[model samples]
Target: MALTPFLVLGFCWLPYYKTSLVFKLCHSVSEAQQRKMGHSNVWNSHPKNYGPGSRTCRVCGNPHGLIRKYGIMCCRQCFRSNAKEIGFIKYR
Candidate 1:
């Protein structure tokens, strides 16, 4: 009967659909975890009590001239590297 072909098609597609859904869910979960870890790493990497206009890089601890960018005191080099964390993009 016609129902037999329809049933076979559904059965063949079911597993592939279920597997794709599971993979997407797992990928999202892992991405969330990675974002959490990246935030923690950024927080721990910066220095403490270091305000703007300080002559030191909060990230690399380089005792040199620093500029205030995105409310954090860091040298030009460090600032360029950490621009993404401060919601800015690094252009080459």
Candidate 2:
């Protein structure tokens, strides 16, 4: 009977590990909306870019558009367009 409580305690550790693996901000249904709007970061090879190619720019699909090199993610262009409306800064 005492062993049952210890087994329950061990089971608590598994859920903590699962939440750590969730990295992507959008997925499934949100991903579909992003695709329909022509804003996805899928990498393609067109004989340029040299090493491995680049992701489809989420801003304008330019392939070489402004994107962070670390994660290849891009925010909506509307962010820059409505910067002051949203109280954001660039030089700060």
Candidate 3:
């Protein structure tokens, strides 16, 4: 238990390191990772909303995404206008 962090650090710093094994297996994004990471929305062209004011809409709280681009991680009801302005184009 005491050596867990060290072991994890070593794995991350290894020359042959690929993706983080724990993240891939657990499929959980830690708060530290969220800054540098964004989920792939390849299939979710029109992401279905679970509902408004939900915790899952955390991105809406971001002043940058909302003020500058209005590109919050919010549902269609909340983000529809700017989503059009943002001009999302599917390439792949």
Across 1-92, the per-residue lDDT of candidate 2 in tens digits comes to 11111111222422323443542421223344535544434543234644325445455665444445455445456346755775668896
Best by lDDT: 1
In model 2, where is the ten-residue run with the lowest total lDDT? 1-10
What ranges in model 2 sit over 4 Å off?
Answer: 1-52, 69-72, 75-79, 82-87
TM-score of each: 0.33, 0.24, 0.19
Model 3 TM-score (2 dp)? 0.19
Which residue pairs clash within candidate 1?
Answer: none
Which ranges in model 3 have alpha carbons more than 4 Å from their true place? 1-72, 89-92
lDDT of each: 0.55, 0.43, 0.41
Candidate 3 per-residue lDDT, tens place, 1-92, comes to 12222222322432224435644333333445543443443445666655442334343453232332353455454465555665766465
What TM-score does prediction 1 earn? 0.33
lDDT-superior candidate, 1 or 2: 1
